[model samples]
Target: MALSIVYGILTTVLTATSWRLGLAVDGILWLVFLVPIILAVIGIINAVNGKMKPLPVIGGIKILK
Candidate 1:
């Protein structure tokens, strides 16, 4: 849930910027968008595979822990 929210927010914010700045900004938005998704994907993969894989900075920076 957290991963989804983080990615969704970043994606929306950056995408909004991209609308005015064009391709380079769009590319950056894409890059920023992947950060949280990659974490969630890794987490899902680890959970499904029966292992613990911490998402780089975020898994360590747990606010609700």
Candidate 2:
């Protein structure tokens, strides 16, 4: 989420400064945003199926004690 926000801010700044660079970075933004969504889906599926598995990338994140 933070990465997405940072990237979005960067893209906005870049766009304000240079349209071309911003456009290029914007193309890659989809990938950055897709990761969290995919992870969430995976987590939900795992939970529904009664499996306790670690998620890729941020699975180790301890949101709750």
Candidate 3:
């Protein structure tokens, strides 16, 4: 969530300053955004079966705790 927001903001800033850089940043951000959704889906499946599992990659970074 926070990471997505940060990427969005950075992409916006880069867009205003440099179109090429903004496109590059946006592409990278697109990939980054998918990670959370995938993790959330995995988490949901785990929860439905009565298990608590952290997401891979970004799971340990407790930003909102």
Candidate 4:
């Protein structure tokens, strides 16, 4: 959620700055969006098997309890 917000802001800023930079930001945003969907799929599989596993990179962060 935080990442998406930050990326949105960055994308807006970059778009205002330059078209080339905005395109680069768009590509990066796509990759960032994929991370959570992939993690959620893995998480769902683990849940079905009764396992509690953290995601690889973002799971360790204690942003919410």
Best by TM-score: 2
Q: Alpha-carbon error at 41 in model 4, in Å?
A: 0.6
Instruction: Please give the distance, in angstroms, between residue 15's alpha carbon in candidate 3 and its true position after superposition.
Output: 1.4
Best candidate according to lDDT: 2
The ten-residue window of minimal lDDT in model 1 covers 19-28
Show where candidate 2 strays beyond 4 Å. 1-9, 58-65
Segments in model 3 whose C-alpha atoms lie over 4 Å from true places: 1-5, 49-65
Q: Is candidate 2 or candidate 4 better by lDDT?
A: 2
Q: Single out the weakest 10-residue window by summed lDDT for candidate 2.
A: 27-36
Q: What is the TM-score of each candidate against the true structure?
A: 0.52, 0.58, 0.51, 0.56
Ranking by lDDT: 2, 4, 3, 1
Which digits, one per residue and each the tens of the lDDT, describe model 4 over residues 13-64?
A: 9989998999898898899798879988888899999998887677789986
Which stretches of model 4 miss by more than 4 angstroms? 49-65
Candidate 3 accuracy as TM-score: 0.51
Task: Give one digit per residue, the lDDT tens place, for model 1 in 1-65.
Answer: 78557656765776677755555555675687688798888788888999977766766786774
Q: Write one digit per residue (lDDT tens) for candidate 3, span 4-62.
A: 68887899999999999999989887987787799888888898999867776667888
Worst 10 residues of 4 by lDDT: 55-64
Tens-digit lDDT string for candidate 2 (1-65): 68768987999999999999999889888776787899899899999999999877877899899
Q: In angstroms, give how far residue 10 of model 2 lies from its true place.
A: 2.4
For each of the candidates, the C-alpha root-mean-square deviation to the true structure, in angstroms, is 6.6, 4.1, 5.4, 4.8
Report clash pairs, candidate 2. Answer: none
